[model samples]
Target: MVELQAATKLDAVFHALGDATRRHMLRDLAGGERSVGELAAPFEISLAAASKHIKALERAGLVRRTVAGRKHLCRLEARPLEGAHEWLGFYKQFWSGRLDILESLLRQEDAAKSQGEDHD
Candidate 1:
């Protein structure tokens, strides 16, 4: 089991996802475990750069790497993802309220436009 870090795991997850390459790497890892070379092939960056991104993901607890013979295989660890879910859940009410307001305003505007067109 992954021990919860001092800083919220959500912080780690978001921090790890801040980079485009890392996010892509996660997407790839979702399918199955991959070697460093397979992960690096999709990006324009060098292998070293991709390795750095993988390192960040590793620190965040979003990825796990194991040595299989000579190759390092990367696997996605979803435990930290739960932290991300918890953090996002906090904003759900706010977004829902704002969306409701916007929807009402749009409906009002549409109603007004329809009535105006009827008068013409």
Candidate 2:
């Protein structure tokens, strides 16, 4: 079903994002396109390792790689990230609401303590 495919895609995106190297690669690509060599430059990882990371990113739809003669150029493909962002947004809202309640409770506690001090 369409929902299942979407869930699978979301899983791939998160799996790609789960690695710090891949995340950094995405961040680097955000600035502009770069060759695999350039992406691999910042890390101590071997070229093959970098390729694996890029492959994971490609599978997640986070990066699009194009072959240019001898070099493979990569660029940020951010549309897939929307699903992740939307998913996280839900939690952000839920946490924000929970935090607001916690803040209110803390404020009420402080107020109660102040009142007790005044009575002493």
Candidate 3:
């Protein structure tokens, strides 16, 4: 049950990250907290569209928004990214190990071929 919940959250995180605009927003927020207008400034998007992207990040636990008078200040939450990183890290390690083994096998094959040539 807990794993399922985690997977669902990860899905949201990946979905949020899947958009280039959202990724740029995340990158901007990484510098510091920014108002919705500030976040929208770099892209040719209206405040409503920017709000929608921020909402997606919020749903994914990637960004936290706080109301300050008329301004909505958004800051990067970043904890959810840790879960995503861990999930990707597992596959990274798996692929790295597999590649290492393949390289070793290729090196051994090359050595055998060299020895055969020398003997001939």
- In terms of lDDT, which candidate is strongest? 3
Pairs with backbone N, CA or C atoms under 3 Å apart (clashes), candidate 1: none
Instruction: Give one digit per residue, the lDDT tens place, for model 3 in 43-82.
Output: 9999999999999999999999999899999999999999
lDDT of 2 by residue, 1-120 (tens): 999999999999999999899999999999999999999999999989999999999999999999989999999999999999999999999999999999999999999999999999
Tell me the spans in candidate 3 whose CA falls farther than 4 Å from its real position. Answer: none
Model 1, position 117, has a per-residue lDDT of 100
- Overall lDDT per candidate, in order of appearance: 0.89, 0.97, 0.98
Stretches of candidate 2 exceeding 4 Å from the true structure: none
Clashing residue pairs in candidate 2 are none
- Predict model 2's lDDT versus the native: 0.97
Answer with 2 or 3, whichever has the higher lDDT.
3
TM-scores for every predicted model: 0.81, 0.97, 0.91
Worst 10 residues of 3 by lDDT: 78-87
Error of 3 at 109 (Å): 2.2
